[model samples]
Target: MRVSLILLFVSFRSISGFSQEAEEKKWSSDFSLELEVENQYFSNKGAYANQLQNFLSGAIKPKYNLQSADGKHLFKVELFFRSSLNDPNRTHFDVREAYYRYNKKSWSVSVGFKKVFWGVTESNHLVDVINQADQVESFDGEEKLGQPMVQFNYPTKIGDFEFYYLPAARRRQFPSDKGRYRFPVAIAREDIPFVNDLKEWHPSFAVRWSKSFGNVDTGLSHFYGVSRDPLYLGFNPATGLDLSYPVINQSGLNLQYTKDAWQFKLESIYRTTERQSFVAAVAGFEYTFGNIRSSGVDLGVVSEYLYDSRGLLTFSGLDDDVFIGARIALNDVKSTELLMGGIVDRTKGTQLYRMEGSRRLGEAWKVAVMANLLNEVSPKEILSNFRTDNLIQLRVSRFF
Candidate 1:
């Protein structure tokens, strides 16, 4: 990664040799900023110390991009910082995207930190494994930390191919003692353990081929190297306990079929490690009722099933579960939308309910609302730690 950075600086520092030198050498830049302030309201008291009922947080995200006239070379940089008045772990910074891309007629190469997503399911993402989860930001796993990698894209008549060389894996952050949805014991963050002596500097590789056939889209991917999910190593006398990131190989498949007002999606993965192997999948379908009563309102119903072969030992506690949800789009000038969903464990009858909605206040202002509720969490389940962590979030964003 260091070598790649050095080469990137040396190559991109000079703009004279980027093109044939005959065309007019032109470069343009764009800058944007978003300011966000949010609050969380918990219905019940926390299970641990320092957990509050109401927490306030704010964040700033700024991005800048530069590109040539012919769109052959491009540069982008984005930064994020959040400050919390209650929890220290919620205050963090991330370099979401700081990458340079060189594009040709048939191929493109990108290097540096960037975000990548891969999955077709609405409830759970079993195939998206490139970036680490930014757990401190959101518990739904929708937010992600940017990953440092070198990506290459090739397009052919059959399919589009992508190759990735990922390095410098980011460790997943946990809530502090003062934060919400915390574990029983505090885990030390410094000097964490990793198998195979690779640590965070392990070099990983991935390849994906995607193609669309008629009304169906498909993607086949394979990843070899470090696993983003951590396994519990054991209790320490001083630090309590820690997690170990092991080396693994995972192959995944994502499929989606769309016909009229119906959509079917599937995402599955087969993963193997030195000690264990397992398969996890999420499959579902969505049906939409468009232009109901000519009111320009669209309503959709969703249902999906989740399964993991690890059973009780599964860290996700989703061994046999089902997700049911609905979506509403107002189709108004304000661009309002709402989504509500719940995941139910078939074995223990526990459930997690979530609802999220957003509406534009005007051209440059927007407001969003989210709520998460837990019900009947069993002690044998992993989500028992969050039984009393049901909370609601309200966020307002100003764009400039």
Candidate 2:
């Protein structure tokens, strides 16, 4: 922390020495703050292993962007405060991003925590932020892991590439705690390991390339990293385990084309380990027309399909199912988008569908709601494996 402050001071001093301009502008620095709130209910809270019930989770974030007059140096910092009403253990306050960059026309180097996003899509909520995504894809095999690091990037005629040397979290094996409940009931909890020697020890490397022609854009990205030693798990006895998981590797391809009011996008990723691999893909399209069309209305449709290899769910106690879903966007009601989707399990004959929608209240705020229903339709399966039949969630966000 002290070193970072020193670096920040030194960088500013160096920037102040550059040739001054005739005029200075306050707008050269930008700052913004935002808040997000979520209200939710879980009918099968029991199914999720006694998780949160109806509750609200919220986060407050502020960010600052600073640039030197010469444009050769740039700095960014963001702080976040998040809390959950039902799950207090999930509360956190930290520096989400803090980085300094040395910039050139074709290349740049950044040191500290940074976010690198790939793909060409109007809304990349899922694809952005490579460091924090799906648990199956971003594994610590442990508890909390991730943050910033020293990263370098270079762009060529063909594509752009980046590398990061980060301190990764250690992976730990989770144990189960079982006990007898009221008269014949059984309750079990996941026991995670916690070790003292654990340090920020994971490092990563990533590369991405994009090419565009006419109205179409396509790109590919790959990331690889190895596990660090003396990793920390959640439980107290975190040592004595060999960090022998396969070196994590992942790669993906994405394509998007837009001509006038119509757009199409496709994205796919393959996650590989020493013993097995998994794949996920989504294809979507949208068409916007209105206002000038005179009716003051716009309409669009989106669809996606997902397939999870059976191996990915083995240790997670999750379902290996195929999912298909679609969404409808209606501009008349303040950019309201409705989503509906379902996942089917081949082995269990169980099916689950989720319904969700979002609407913009203004330029800076939005609200979203979601509901889920799950059922088993085939060979009267035992409910012992089932936890809940429905769930509901509502969220509101203010963005800067």
Candidate 3:
């Protein structure tokens, strides 16, 4: 792997030199950097927090752009590195995006690692958002995919429709505390062929089309792939085998409308495999004040719903059968952004809400104090079924 990476670097450098010398002029570039910090807490310590008492993390990301001296060709790359403040196995580096493009008049093609989410919903817990997929990582995490892929776009009267192909890729997997596998199992020596032959390759692909009518945007996408790695089927230690499942085959549709300070979004996805199948959907809305005095005085609210029939709740049981919640933010008032919300369980009627307040310390930094109260109302199983926890976080974010 190291040798291949070195060779790739060398090859790109050589090509760049030749192009630089042959072309009449050279290209210019731009750069930017961003940083974040977060602190978090969990309700079910047994399920959510298996490591220490709480979790904290920080990340620094940088992006670079390259363009031809004649301003015709464009190349861009992005990298993100995250480090756990206390957890042992939570540190990792990732290539968020690395793609290049040549702009003409009407068409463009991007090839390499890129960010593509299929929804416009606020409660993206049901859809995929590379940057903010997981709620627990709201302060300092991302759900990014890095693959060798190609995407082409063409503009029509309505909007731009895109076609994408991923010839081969190895998607990153995040393992939960219960039993998560970060990498594929190695072919044991006993199972190896007598001639020492091993196969290690995977392919994945996707196609999507989107269009907008007035302020409404709608899209549909499909994805299919076969991977040599083992999918998280289920946990079974009795057979000395981590469950193995087939590749991913899925499809989804997204619809959204944004106009006059009002926004609405909807997303639905269906994932099927030999082991199980599940369908998830999310609906959300937000209304801002167009004539508000301060950016902080605007009104904000978001809600989400989720359902999974695959019987596997990701991120622990936290991704349970259903979730409904709301968020409200009051800006510039007492220099605070008060966010209060709750999520309820359908079967048990258990609920949780937030008692948190965040204030900006400066242009690039903010501090928050929060309390997650479980079963705020008087309940029968207050102690056993419900409890409360407090979380305090001071975040300093900088953009360049």
- Point to the candidate with the largest TM-score: 1
Off by over 4 Å in 1: 1-24, 232-242
TM-scores for every candidate against the unseen true structure: 0.93, 0.67, 0.70
Candidates' C-alpha lDDT = 0.85, 0.54, 0.54
Candidate closer to the true structure by lDDT (higher is better), 1 or 2: 1
Compose the digit string of candidate 2's lDDT tens values, residues 98-166: 777899988888876555666543222223324542121112122222355677787777766666665
Sliding window of 10 residues with minimal summed lDDT for model 3: 189-198
The residue-level lDDT of candidate 3 at 77 comes to: 72
Between candidates 2 and 3, which one is better according to TM-score? Answer: 3
lDDT (tens digit, per residue) of candidate 1 on 13-104: 64335445425576777889999999999989889877788889999999978798889988887878899998788898887777889999
User: What does candidate 1 score on TM?
Assistant: 0.93
Candidate 2 runs further than 4 Å off? 1-27, 48-52, 119-129, 134-146, 169-200, 226-246, 257-265, 278-294, 311-336, 343-350, 360-365, 377-389, 397-400
Prediction 3 global C-alpha lDDT: 0.54
